[model samples]
Target: MKPKDIVLDFYKSDVLLDKKTVSELLHPEVTIDWNSSEGFIQMDYEDMMSLTDQMARAYIRSKIRISHILQEDNLVSLRFSHFVKTIENPREDMLLGNFFVIWEIKDEKLFKGFQMSHFS
Candidate 1:
């Protein structure tokens, strides 16, 4: 897949809760630097897998709605919002945040990322 397509598929996937998908899309040495409303966080592949497990326990389902996407070579940038249905209230989807992220695809997987987000 093209870099843009890989990143798009990653976001369109159930990445928050599915470890198998995450493993498939993320490189073994993947690393992400994220700035969110909560604070800054740096995560590696294992951290990402752990986060997926945690989200699985906390949310019933989740989705990403992309507003914009741009690609330059192996770099793909996207703007989107995340919505989730909590385990406690599975019937309603709550807006989790709005995000802007740039991903670098290497070895046909998400190798590196820089992301920023704020609460919606």
Candidate 2:
């Protein structure tokens, strides 16, 4: 699959919460810059793995709804909404909010990412 397709699939995998699928799509030295209410942050592959596990444990059910996707060469940009249900109560629909992300693919794997988001 194309790198962009892999990323889209990765977002869809939020519903499944499959670590294997998530891991397989990432580059070993993946880097990420994330910005949200907490402010700007950065991460490496290990950090990404840790967050993946935490997210799986924190959200009972979740889905990423993509609004748009654009790709050029190995770079991709996407706009999406992240929706989830907490582990405490799986009924309440918590919209962690919408986001825009730019991803860089290296050797057909997701090697870098930058995200800006708003949380509710």
Candidate 3:
């Protein structure tokens, strides 16, 4: 699948609350640098799964709207806004963030991914 397609699928799965599909789109060795209200958090695949589970427990109603996608070879830069409502709070609290993801694809499967996100 195209890199953009993979990303769109990731967001679609996330919106559907399908963890399996989200996980399938991720590379096993993925590295994520996520900047949030708390701080800059660095994570790998295992950590990503843990975070996803936590979000699920929080039962967030989320939507990701992609503004732009730029791809060259194996690198992808995505600009998106993630809107979410925390189940516990039930308030419309949105996270506006931009992501830059670099992928290493081999044999049509993602071997590795490095991502950085900034939120405001």
Q: TM-scores of the models, in the given order? A: 0.95, 0.91, 0.73
Tell me the lDDT of model 3 at 69: 77
List pairs with backbone clashes in candidate 2: none
Ranking by TM-score: 1, 2, 3
Please give the lDDT score for candidate 1.
0.92
In candidate 2, position 57 carries an lDDT of: 84
Model 3 collision count: 0
- Tell me, by lDDT, which candidate is best: 1
Which candidate gets the maximum TM-score versus the true structure?
Answer: 1
TM-score of 3: 0.73
RMSD of 2: 1.5
Global Cα lDDT for candidate 2: 0.85
By summed lDDT, the worst window of 10 consecutive residues in model 2 runs over 13-22
lDDT of each: 0.92, 0.85, 0.65
Q: Which structure is stronger by lDDT: 1 or 3? A: 1
Q: What digit string (tens of lDDT, one per residue) describes model 2 on residues 53-113?
A: 8888888787888889999988999999888989888878788888999999998888999
